[model samples]
Target: MTPFEPDRSEDLLNRLKQDDKQAYEKIYFTFSKELLYAAYKKTGDRVIAEELVQNIFISLWEKRQDLQINNLQAYLFGALKLSVINHIRSLVMENKYMEYQMLTYSENHQDTANLVDLHDLSSIIEEGINSLPEKTQEVFRLSRYQHQSTKDIATGLNITEKAVEYHITRSIKRIKEYIKNFYIFL
Candidate 1:
């Protein structure tokens, strides 16, 4: 509404700090929609925007007694902005981790690629591949050889992505063992 007029706001704030449910509901109904719109404009995700606003209200209620504010609108907007930045930072870190995983497990095979002939190695790798059960072998090939994402492999194979991950892990462990033993004897 019109910023809750100062006298009413002061009364509501006092009730809120005292854990009055109706006062909390009053504040939520007044500010939540506007906060959601502001958050959506900043984050460009409707679901995340809604979540941020809900989190703000929850935090407001939990820390109501500790909060002191001359302008409630300013406080809510400022808190939403900080929460949005934190969410963006978390997403960026998750993306970087996925990229790191892809690069670490990439097909470059750096160490042995330089020391061994790929033909000999491929044959030894083939031995490891042949040893796997059929379904595990399929998932591993899709993930490693074809460079398909776990999502893609899961969709293509009609299996859960977690299942694809398990198969990839099982196959990689078996193949690495084969390669390591081959290196030791050489």
Candidate 2:
């Protein structure tokens, strides 16, 4: 047997296809740092990036039997890019889902006071709002239930305009999260 050349990725690929553990470790050691850094740069979270890298490499190993890659690094990076894109999309998907839920709840609520009065759901929403931190809950109620302007809320709360906006955004996110959980019960 000729001596193995670590510089030749084709040789590594061949060895990997044969389920050679050492070759797998070599590839992982060679590329894991770069892959991790790439994932982190895109994700902004070390734990998530690390998990993404691990999952990608695990998939590579699992599919080694039939995998044909002329450039393994490129293949892995492509997979990572897709993973990051999907991950980022999932956040938007969550917000979109929350909007859809709120819309559905409102429409159904308005359409059928006779069938199912929204008082019960309103109570749930109220509960979600009440669960917010005191200042946040107060700020949200003033903005939403009271229809007060941001300036009014800020002046009343003795906080800055930006702080009021931040509180409102935080409250909305928390309320949406709570309602999503409440929806599971329904």
Candidate 3:
């Protein structure tokens, strides 16, 4: 590629600062390929390299009025290098976030599986409660399901406190046996 003459480069820079579209186009055509090659060499990806170079030109145009470029070529190359570094940093952060999300999802999946097992155990216990004698079912339901105290259960059922305790113990023993047999069959 032919290098820009010193006088011509000075003229281009002055015109570019004044928002001259033709000057901007000349600069783009002169430097775009070199910048793309440099970006690709650093990043090793053609698409990313192209995007970085494009963004550099876009930023140059947007900030043309504010730019005080002593050497346009050096400035463009410097921007390309910084952009590539930032892109790599973003990729690393994205990978770490994805890994964390995957770990959390796996843990949550295990919790969901445990909840399903607990639900099945609850259903089995309900079946055992249903199989109890009618009076025992009333006492067990009042004490466990309704969260009533043993004394309250005896008063409500008009039974002695000892009878309430006996029914609770009997219900627990039968449910434990039912659960053990159910798991053995599974």
Candidate 4:
């Protein structure tokens, strides 16, 4: 690879600021590989390094009009270092979160893989509701499923609004208790 000549890089950056395509290509050819290798040395990941380099160039291009890059290499390396550090820190945090979640799952007793089907769970819940006394079922369906206001349902059913409120609250508490134990296992 040809060494990056500072004079040429400065002239190219100036011309690229004026929207010259040739200058842009010359800059890309001269600096892309060196910047990639520099970033990769810090990141140890080709994909992340490549992405950082790409972002740096795009940022440079966007700010070309106001850029005063006395030393192109220094400016590029500074940008590369910042980008790589940010990427690595994020990766470290993500790995820590995954490790913690794995450990939490292992300590729980239930076999997550043997959990009942979600569809079956829903069917079982509906069947249980259907088996309730007729009055409780009507109040449960109106408040929970149909989303009717208790006051409106009480007016329509000619019962006290307190009775409607009591039935909905009890049904919701029962559903919550049932799901809580199952979810902890998962």
Q: All candidates' TM-scores? A: 0.55, 0.52, 0.54, 0.51
Show where candidate 1 strays beyond 4 Å: 1-4, 107-186
| Model 4 bad stretches (over 4 Å) | 1-3, 103-186
**Which lDDT values do the candidates have, in the order given?**
0.80, 0.78, 0.82, 0.72
TM-score result, candidate 4: 0.51
Candidate 2, residues 137-185, lDDT tens digits: the string is: 8898899889999899889888998678667766766776666676566
Residue ranges of candidate 3 with Cα displaced over 4 Å: 1-5, 107-186
Q: Best by lDDT, which number? A: 3
**Model 2 poorest 10 in a row by lDDT:** 1-10
Residue 144 lDDT (model 1):
78
lDDT of 1 by residue, 20-59 (tens): 9899888888888999898899899986787678778767
TM-score, prediction 1 = 0.55
Q: What does candidate 3 score on TM?
A: 0.54
